[model samples]
Target chain A: MISKSVAQFVRSLHQKKYRQQEGCFLVEGAKSVQEVLSSTFEVDLLLTTDAFYKENADGADRQRCRIETATAEELTRVGTLESNNAALAVVRMRANVPLLRAPDAWVLVLDDIRDPGNLGTILRIADWYGIDTILCSETTADVYNPKVISASKGSFTRVNWWYGDLTGVLNQANAPVYGAFLDGDDVHQSPFNAAGGYIVMGNEANGIGPNITPFVTQRITIPRYGDAESLNVGIATAVILDNLRRVQG
Target chain B: MISKSVAQFVRSLHQKKYRQQEGCFLVEGAKSVQEVLSSTFEVDLLLTTDAFYKENADGADRQRCRIETATAEELTRVGTLESNNAALAVVRMRANVPLLRAPDAWVLVLDDIRDPGNLGTILRIADWYGIDTILCSETTADVYNPKVISASKGSFTRVNWWYGDLTGVLNQANAPVYGAFLDGDDVHQSPFNAAGGYIVMGNEANGIGPNITPFVTQRITIPRYGDAESLNVGIATAVILDNLRRVQG
Candidate 1:
């Protein structure tokens, strides 16, 4: 049985304030915990059921953490996921890394993406399209939020995320910036530069912010055939990336 | 001010059983309620704040429905959305219309898409791409669910949804059946028939079920460039539709 204080401590990480204060965040469920174990982050706490421990405890990284045995019910009580049956881990947050210049690789730049689920889905789409890094405006949703982590599935492990000034990064990096806009060049017909660059997705309700617009070298749009107002930012990301890759390939 | 009994009755529609029994469902927030007013579905009740009623009551469709003045606090208490400052409508559910054969236009076929949000997003994507009809397995989430309605935004008004046997519809469809599979031909390379047909999307965890596999005349895939396991079903749908539109256009 887990102690009440420990359970309380684990639950506290659910809030952004507590997570920032502690410099650690919760990763729950079997898939996420496994991804955390395999990732570069240091595990501060690893609470798992006997079955999960028996199956995955053999890894060397498991020995580096403060591991504890707990029941599935105990995990569900402490975890953000309602139906977590296996494990929950508190992984240490990495320091904010500066954006790197990689002109040959497509990077996703997000501006004020408010929804955690949308941010997470974009991360997963970035991972799927081999876009290794994501640069987010300071106003964007916190990447370490449990909902964002949960929505990303295991793709969070592979995608590098950084929240900083989008304009600063776009200006510093020697790459063309392509923004998703309402009345822009048709994505299907727009000729993408063979050398990769940046694709900036904007806020859900608002398109690209004015601060970031001047840095954009090209404004591209996903052609719409019907009357729906706009595509969800996450869906738009995937659709745009698919087109980007098709053009590059 | 709304009556207490009426508020309680409206709240009960949150559950599927109550909605089915009453043949009605809730549409919350301003955009959705506006769509419900304009649609063919009869509105049983329209609960609106004074501001919304003052601004939009001039519309001709408002005369056709029972319009009630309600406060924002009363709406927040009775509705599913936390910040519903505008309106909520109790809409009568339409009878399930059988799937129509749309050989010349795209019809999205869903197999056990369980999440209301995914189903809703798919409906929005369908509306965006001008795919008028969505055919779903009976196992799919209810189209009238409040979460689905909210996620679809106003696109639910434009899209026709029917839940029935997938095999029967595919067999009867006079056009080619295209199924999204990981092992299928690359969608970018695969030539889409200019005459539109059916595009079958699968469930969250599983791909297209075995029973539905035999009917797929063409197997297509979105090429992945990175290590992410899979795309969310909704994102996958929009990407596929974008490609299909690109090919057809």
Candidate 2:
């Protein structure tokens, strides 16, 4: 049972400003809620349907988090995901930890990716490709946005994201830097090292920003077979990672 | 110069029912509106700002279509794209022409792509990869949806889409059938013919439907390097097409 004040607080967390002030963000839908329950993210509150509660009540973390049963209608009203009938969790935002670049694993650097959905999808792609760390420019979409959280499909729990000056971070990184371009060396034939490196994906409408350009040691292009002015950034990231994995494997 | 009746009609096209009833769909934003003007699609109406009118009024097709001046506010209110400030064109739905499966060109078969954005992104991927025709199951999202058009980023004009039974179309196609699966042959090492074939992409959550399963002669999988449970359907399509092009090129 949700009190009026608790309901208002949960609803407030939907907006980034409120989330920043409260130091927490929402994780909607069953998959993501379950993922956070098992991850290092500390859950402040869990509003869910009785069925979801029944299914997860035995988990060890249940003792540490506050749980409340919510009707489907209440969940829809409070959560950004209208179709979510399972749960929504208020997760405390951990301090921004510096991304640790593993010598043998690739790290994704995002340059001003604005769309929440694209950012979220990119996280999932990173998670799938075993790339653990993502460095986002300060202008990139907030990862805590409900849209991003929903789109990441629980992969957010596994991937570490740090937001700051991308140019500064990439410049200091230990590995080789590869940037995607329209007229660069074809990714299929490009020299890719099995020792992982940094792959920088640019903004949706704009390619890599001007500041980050000088840091790219190698320029790569995904050859286009037909006339699409460009590929969507999220799709491009996944395609690049897939190619990267092919070479590494 | 926008008429009350015209505004009501344009607003109604946002719904699939009205689009189907009117036998037309909207081409919103400057890029898509321009593409439709140059394409074979018959434009029934064009609502635009004065700047757009001055820019495009010289086109030969201008004589064949009705043109009206609309404020940015009006365009935002009537069109599905809220950010659109340039123009919107109401294009007649051309009859579903039989897919011209060029024997040496690949074709995409969508099993049950339900998201309009995913479907649109897939179309752009198809357009980029030179896959000219797409056979979609009746359950697939309508190609004429504004979200699909917006996401396609003008690729809608280059591609031909047909809605029908998946089983019937695959059984009738002259090319070999390839299905994407988790346990199928690794796409990296899979034998791909330079001659065009039908590549089947399944539903977002359900993968391929059972009814369409029997027609796939070859099963191919994109090997996972990370633990992401599955790639989004749109990402999967682009990745598969990229690999196919690698072999075909």
Write one digit per residue (lDDT tens) for candidate 2, span B120-228: 9999999999888899999999999999999899999998999987787787877788999988888888456667788999899899999999998889998988778
Which residue runs of candidate 1 sit more than 4 Å off their true CA positions?
Answer: A60-63, B60-63
Kindly report which residue pairs in candidate 1 clash with one another. Answer: none
Q: Per-residue alpha-carbon lDDT of model 1 for B1-249, expressed as tens digits?
A: 999888999999999999999999999998888777877778888899889887778652554777788888999899899788999999889889896865578789999999999999999999999888898899999998999999998898898888888898887778889999988888888557788888999989998999899999999988999988899999999988888889885
Taking all chains together, the TM-score of candidate 2 against the true structure is 0.97
Per-model tally of clashing residue pairs = 0, 2
- Candidate 1 residues A83-143, lDDT tens each? 8889888889988898684758888899999999998898889889988888889999999
Tens digit of per-residue lDDT, candidate 2, span A167-199: 778768778899999878788884566787889
Q: What interface RMSD does each of the candidate structures achieve? A: 0.7, 0.6
Candidate 1 chain A minimal-lDDT segment of 10 residues: A57-66
Alpha-carbon lDDT of model 2: 0.88
Which one wins on lDDT? 2
DockQ of each: 0.89, 0.88
- In model 2, the Cα lDDT at residue B140 comes to 96
Name model 2 segments beyond 4 Å from true. Answer: A60-63, B60-63
